[model samples]
Target: MAQKIIGMLGGMSWKSSAEYYRLVNEGVRDRLGGLHSAQCLMWSFDFDDIAVLQREDRWNDAADLMVEAAQRLERGGADFLIICTNTMHKAYDRLRAAVDLPLLHIADPTAERIKADGHKRVGLLGTAFTMEQDFYKGRLADLHGLDVIVPDATDRATVHRIIYDELVQGKVEAASRDAYRAVIGRLVAAGAEAIILGCTEIMLLVGPEDSPVPLYDTTGLHAAAAVELALG
Candidate 1:
């Protein structure tokens, strides 16, 4: 098979975008070897526009912008599009509606892996949209038949703070990690066999060590799925 080209809709925050770029490229290199990393066509948005979308929760509007972006990628010769940020994926449907290119949805792979690993109930941590909306979780339940759990109001607030104020803003603090570990512990005590680090930024703050349950890093899962399609 010929090498595939993937496009990234990035810059929701550049931090996670950097991780996706590194992970997809590195995944490709490791598979094919000889410096044959992923062939990516990237279109990054400005922080200002992203911030506005985040603040207002204007998901459809935000996704429409990305639809244009993905269409441009299609024109630029990319075979598919990856929304580099988890929160931004809230508009995934809009982008899918707007484009003909195949978009490898991140939540499905995570859900499939969760089922394959024999996990029934999994706790989720992500931005407000993914946590509150039925889009990702509904897909997991309806499509994959996986049970998904999210943090309560209080824990969700703390997790959101840790992601937006600390991780996304680039303030990585040890204290932040401890706070998140406490959240993970609570989720596990509530019967979560595995914890889904649904936010890419959360993976940086809390790793598997912090979780009493298994940690499913959404960033890594998303990257691995991207590699599977891009390198097929």
Candidate 2:
């Protein structure tokens, strides 16, 4: 059997999408020897438009846009799909229904790692939409049986602002990093055993060394999973 082609719908910020591309191809190369990389197709979106729809609570429209993107990937001969953003997965059902190709959920790989590590509770850090919404936390709790904690309202606002104003723009500041550590501290105080870097762009700001507990980089995990599926 031929290796499956991985399809990604990304560029929600381009910051994390760039990481996904590098990680996916790197994973393939590491496993398959020199010169081998993922046979991948990517559909990058305009983050400006998606952000406007999200800000206005027009997820139906956002979902419609993703569905169209997924169809294009499918037509381009993609065997499986990856949404590439945690917040965007809010439209998972709609996007999945519109395409026949298997769509990998970013949460699944994170949950799998958490479960394997015997962590019953975890903290989640991501965009306000991903943190505040049930699409992500609910999936971890309901589907994977993990307790999830998010930053409080104030901290959530700080995190969200840092993501858009700093991280997505490719700017990393010491103060912003400190702010993230403080929020992670709060989650740790709330009994979180591990932390999920739910936003792909988040790993840029906070990483394993920054956290007291184990840090799960969702982008790396998701990309690794895509490589596994592609190789098989």
Candidate 3:
């Protein structure tokens, strides 16, 4: 079978986008063996401009940018689209409306993983918008029948701050890791069966060891799912 070309709409921060590229290529090689790599096209953005729109509450503007990128990927011969960042998924509906290609939403695979593991309740750690808004958590609850929990307001701020201020820039501090561990601990205490590193960048800061329960890395799951679709 001919491999489908995966369309990657990324660079909400290039750090996580790089991980997606590596993981997709590695997945293809591991499955198809020796020298095989993902058939993919990437349209990376200048996230600084995207961030400015986000901060200014110009979501429509941000969505416009996403639409433009997705359209570019479609024209470039991509069979489907994957938006690499969790937060940017807030604009998902708009992008979907604007593009003709199928979109592999980042949340669906993560929710499936959690359910497959027999987890009904999971904690999410991501940018403030993902946690506070309905776009992501609502999708888990509405579409997947999963109970999603997030840290308290204070911890949410900490998570959001570290994402934009540190992780996105490729800075990973032990102190930030420790802070995340503490947040994960609290979420577990609050009856979280597992933790979802909902932000792509959060996986860079914390992992399974930091949480008492299982840790789901959205970035990894999303990439693997893309590979499955591309090669299936």
Candidate 4:
């Protein structure tokens, strides 16, 4: 049988969507020792639509958008689908319900990595929605027992603004990077042994260097896992 094609449901900025594409292909090449890449079917939104829905908290409508993209990929012959944004995952269950393709859960796989390494306490850095909402936190605390930490209210606003306004807009200002470094420092000081880069775009702005503590790049990890599944 030919390799099963992976489908990416993207356009959660399309910037991070670019990262998913590069990493998925690179990871596949690394494992298979050639120019191999996960055969992928991808569709991207305009980002304006996704942004407005996110800002207004129209989660069901946003999920509908993703489900529509996923259905299109299915019709195009994709085997499994992954939504590239961590924030977009807020609508995971609803999207999964609307589409027939298997929706790979990024949080679970990243959480499993934390658990496998015996990291009991982890700090999370993402959009305000992912940090403050029940969807992401409940899964980390209840499902995995991996205690999750987050920045304070002021810092939360900083990270949220930086992500949506600056980073997603493709301006990776050094000041914004320093701002995130400060937040990571505080999280570690508060007893986080590792920090989860809950947003896919974050790794682009700050990598392992900005943190003294262990850093889990969820974007890289998730794409690597998707490559693994596609190759198998």
Clashing pairs in 3: none
- Tens digits of per-residue lDDT, candidate 3, 1-232, equal 5899999998989999999999999999999997899999999999999999999999999999999989999999999999999999998999888988899999999999899999999999999999999999999999999999999999999999999999999999999999999999999999999999999998888877888899999999999999999999
Q: Give each model's whole-structure lDDT.
A: 0.83, 0.92, 0.94, 0.88
Query: Backbone clashes in each candidate structure, one number apiece?
Result: 0, 0, 0, 0
Estimate candidate 4's RMSD in Å. Answer: 1.2
lDDT of 2 by residue, 184-227 (tens): 99999999999999899999988777889999999999999999
Cα deviation at 130, candidate 4, in Å, is 0.5
Model 1 per-residue lDDT tens digits across residues 155-221: 8888888787888877889988888888888888888999888877777777777877888887889
Candidates in descending lDDT order: 3, 2, 4, 1
Sort the predicted structures by TM-score, highest score first: 3, 2, 4, 1
Compared with the true structure, what per-residue lDDT tens digits does model 4 show for residues 63-136?
88887888899899999988898988888888788778788888988998998988989999999999999798
On the 0 to 100 scale, the lDDT of residue 10 in model 2 is 96
List the lowest-lDDT window of 10 residues for candidate 4. Answer: 29-38
Q: What C-alpha lDDT, on a 0 to 100 scale, does residue 102 get in candidate 1? A: 89
User: Clashing pairs in model 2?
Assistant: none
